[model samples]
Target: MTDASTVIAKPVSQNRAIWQQFRTHRGALFGLIVLGVLAVVVLIGPYLWIPEKLSVAEAIKLKNQGPSWRFPLGTDQLGRDMLARMMLAGRISLAVGLVAMTIAILFGTLIGVLAGYFRRLDGPLMRLTDMFLALPLIPLLLVLVMLFRDRVASIIGPEMGAFALIVFAIGITSWMSTARIVRGEVLTLKEREYVLAARSIGARPHRIILRHILPNVISPVMVSATLEVANAIITESVLSFLGLGFPPDFPTWGRLLFDGLQYMQVYPERVIWPGLAISLTVLSVNYIGDGLRDALDPRIRGR
Candidate 1:
């Protein structure tokens, strides 16, 4: 029987090993820190500044004002606070990306696990996932957004229409990669000795999957989910810029960039700010994802 001291020491040792692995990748470590800082600023910084309310009219000021001590990033054409809007908008954009990816991961894992574990279902399940993969994602999103604009708005309200659209669009298309990855992992894991041992021990199929299979396979799924956040955010921005996303009243980084596009020649900063935001956010996420992939995989660590 394990003593209390032994139990406590085991987790501590495991955590130290994980940290050692994570610390080995300098770029990933930096990316992790950047992501953590950005997430905190986006989630908590805005509330501290404007706890009273979020008013469009009140937030607006001198239009096209260049970066000043007061405005920092400067005001938009609508005279809204650029910095404030950025902070606020980050919350929505990041939230949409995360939530959408979560939905995709959950759904994809379910389908992949079932298809891999059940030999009979593999062909049909994979075929359907392939169909989605075969289609052009952007054009399909465009058509879906146009067709379901009103219905989507009705369900989630006008304020959240763009966010909802981004979530749904990304969720649907993003799952294909996850499904494929999970399927591959599950197929390999299902063949392992532990799985056969679990089966021989009178473990039900569900118990075998939950207790033995998912644990070994979930690392790749986590990395895929992180990378998907960047993809979903970029896709949302693209849709919003095309005017197929949120209304003018709702300000996301994409819509801000769209509004600034007309003034690109006159006021390039307008375009620059939002574009930079999108680029940095996506880059940071991707870097972190790469880091996680290396950290979790022992083969990569050796290199």
Candidate 2:
């Protein structure tokens, strides 16, 4: 169905140009590499280095040990290996960020593009966005968790159920800003010369949006996506800190930090590893987002 030669000749060059553009920003490149490596480590490290000592009994005697050869980041109050727990924690934290971002992006982009492209839906959608913006996010999340946590847990097993509930709550709560950003971009893009050209050729509104509008507005959408991931991660951590998210036995970075707070004076490593992980992850994502914004922007790509 497709001509290999045509793609080989044309698409390769286009991709090369994009890659070159992306590579121009040193910080973005570094962030991309770090993020890629961190993702791999978190996703794979758990399997290769089993955290068999994750259970309570193993840590009972080994508790509160500092960093050493046996336990790289040292043992926690329960003596669980910090290194192993961090890997598994990274898995859950990253998963929450990614899944939540996907839901947010899909809903935000849809609402934004529609509201921006059509006048009929604009007022209602924007009003809804404004209403959400006005609400207190933390309180709203607490209410949702209280109301549906058990119900959701009953529908799905606790692990996945908590995952879905947290992701859904964060995604629903966080889409307003993205929607606004996308709507603003769409409003500008719809007036562009190419969009007008598409209209002159009798293109359907949906087709024009899909083929012309969305592609052009992707830069901002991507920027929003990165920020959304960071936000979701932090929000989940907060939920865990409040004991409303994943179960207590789970090793989320936030939970780890919360657990280690009281022991900070004695065994600081309990807080250090997870805290550093959260800080580094958020910082890397922010840098990557910054790099992406410049690389993906036509105006700045080559500069």
Candidate 3:
């Protein structure tokens, strides 16, 4: 009989190995550190910085000001503090990315598992996935926002309504790729000996899927989630830049970009700040995902 310590030790060793593999990827390690730093700064920044409660007349005095000890990042065209705005925008953008990815992963996993596990569901669900894949993503998102934004804004307050609409639109639309990946993984996993053994024993489908299939498929799902976060951020940015995402007064990285566009020639830093934030964030997430894909796969990890 196996000892309890042996079982525990084996898992610990395996996790250590996986972490070692992840660390070997320099890009991934860098991304992890950068992301951590960004998260911490954004979370604590507003409390520390304390944006001034300025009236329009007072705000006008600070408008178009360059960086100084007073405002490290400088002031925007409207005299808003760039550093404070950056921290706030980072919080919103990161929140959107994480929330949207969660929605996509949950929905995609459900559809993919059902389609892959049950023979009856395979064809129809796959076809539905295909139909969604064929549609133009930007156009569909635009249509969704146009159709529902006003009604949603009315039901909830405008800010929250826009947030929900943007997150849902991005999440629902982005799941097709994840669904396809998960379906393929599930198809292969269902044919494995353990799964066949579970089926032969008359285990319920739900039980088998929960106990066996889902755990096996988690690696791919985790990798997909990272990519989904980047996709969601970029999508939200696009919508905001187009002036359809959030209310004008509500600042997001995308909104900052939109506002800075007109000032691009004169105050180029206005455009640069938000643009760099978006680009670096997306790139970091993609690198992290790439590293995770390698670290999570046994074959690659072993190498």
Candidate achieving the largest TM-score: 3
| lDDT by residue for model 1 (1-303), tens | 888776754334544555677788787777778878878988888877653343676655477889988778887886777788888878888887898889889888988998899899999999999999899999999999898888878987977775777688779888988988999999999989989988988999999999988888788998999888999889889988998877887777888889989988988888898898788888888888877887778675553
Q: Which stretches of model 1 miss by more than 4 angstroms?
A: 1-12, 50-61, 300-303
Clashing pairs in 2: none
Considering lDDT, which of the candidate structures 1 and 3 is the better prediction for this target? Answer: 3
Poorest 10 consecutive residues of model 1 by lDDT? 8-17
* TM-scores for the candidates: 0.89, 0.90, 0.95
Q: 1-303 in candidate 2: lDDT tens per residue?
A: 898766755344655666777788787788788888889989989888775535567668788888888887887777778888889999999999999999999999999999999989999999999999999999999999889989988998788888999999999999999999999999999999999999999999999999999988787899999999999999999988788888867778988888888999987777888888888888888888887777676677543
Candidate 2: stretches off by over 4 Å: 1-12, 52-58
Task: Give the distance in Å from residue 131's predicted Cα in candidate 2 to where it truly belongs.
Answer: 1.1
lDDT of 2: 0.87
Q: Model 3 compared with the native: what TM-score?
A: 0.95
- Superposed on all Cα atoms, the candidates' RMSDs to the truth, in angstroms, are 4.3, 5.0, 3.4
Query: How should the candidates be ordered by TM-score, best one leading?
Result: 3, 2, 1
- 2 or 3: which has the higher TM-score? 3
* TM-score winner between candidates 1 and 3: 3
